[model samples]
Target: MKTKKLLTLFLLISGLSFYFSQEVVIKDDKVLLDGKQILKAEKINVLQYSFYSMKDDEEILMFRQMDNETPKYMDDDYYVLNFLTEKTKVESTDFTKILNFMNSRKAMEKLIKWLLKERVINNDGELNPERVQTFKEKYDENITDRTFR
Candidate 1:
């Protein structure tokens, strides 16, 4: 009975994943959803495959052991983003509140990256030979593929 129940649960989760992923296509600077151009990207950036936090005003390239940040006195109008795997296209809106987040699979990919990095790189800010291998395994360009529909 235990094995049967586990199989049922695993199958259910697998089916759900397939159902949720729809096709998103890129055309020019815009992303098409359900064959509709719903979002467009102005800029795209990919760094040395480091985990990112929109909360962190600075982009932390952990492998490089450095941070990429705008000049301290720059205006707040600028925005940055990380994307779902294999895409760099994100969307922004000019609304009443802050517009500082991306609209792609930003949450999923970022979390996965952080978790993978954490595994090889132990706590206390240590980077072992294994950690360097992991970082290279997940490297992406400063502006690879952007525009997730």
Candidate 2:
């Protein structure tokens, strides 16, 4: 009886773990968060653009790769600096919105460090204000006159 109880308890814990497991997968150019499609990518010209659809909004967040080269040993180089409407309308905006949103927040610090780690931005000095400013300039330059799919 004790052995049966122990086995039942083990089975119960295993079942619970499986039930609570969350899966993240990128299959067929679609990003699946917990088995739900959140973002989808399409190759356009030399860049691969991914659009994220919000459940409650008609607008979708758009991201694009900086270059055509896919990083084999690193994460994909993309940034969410734009959005689009349901009718495939591109929104005219700049880095101000992203900069303001991330300013003075922990996300800003994390992004700066991540950019440095990914070699997206140079590390002149930790206290240098131009580190982020330089990135803003590059972002604005590349995002100008974007072609939408």
Candidate 3:
């Protein structure tokens, strides 16, 4: 009976540790998973739009439409947009507030500029290639372009 109780306790503790350790965090101009940096900024073009990516084993695209001239679905004035590869699966979150925050021009531009200066995004408004490659190797998949539907 004592052995059974101790075994159960050990299994419970190990499961809890594994579950809590795999959290994803978006903060400080960076996205972290398991306490490691996975994404570091946004790419913005006021005349067009802006985009960013979270570097997981699979890359996830986060974007915002900046102009009315673009298609209606892409013109989400209230929220930032997210796209995932066909092979990726994510537990969804209610992104309503996050979208509202991204809708602010000043906040968006500031983030874009900071990311650019830090070279988290390049001059051509693209994610750092080395990071993309790293994700590719880890996931054994190519990053897909799903920006336009």
Task: Point to the candidate with the largest TM-score.
Answer: 2
> Estimated TM-score per prediction?
0.28, 0.30, 0.28
- Model 2, residue pairs in steric clash: none
Model 2 residue 77 CA deviation (Å) reads: 16
Question: What RMSD value applies to candidate 1?
Answer: 16.7
Q: Quote the positional error of residue 108 for candidate 1 in Å.
A: 12
lDDT for model 2, please. 0.41
Q: List CA RMSD, all candidates.
A: 16.7, 15.8, 11.8
Candidate 2 local lDDT, residue 124: 28
Per-residue lDDT value at 88 in model 2: 28
Over 13-108, each residue of candidate 2 has an lDDT whose tens digit, in order, gives 999988875444445755454666644534343323433333442324344334324466323333443434322222223433323342323223
**Residue-level lDDT tens digits of model 1 in 1-149:** 99999999999999998786444444454334446543342223432234322233233222111122434643322222333332332222221222215433343233333433445323322234454444435543232234232
State, as a TM-score between 0 and 1, how close model 1 is to the true structure.
0.28
Q: At residue 125, give the lDDT of candidate 3.
A: 42
- Candidates, ranked, lDDT: 3, 2, 1
Deviation in Å, model 3, residue 57 alpha carbon: 17
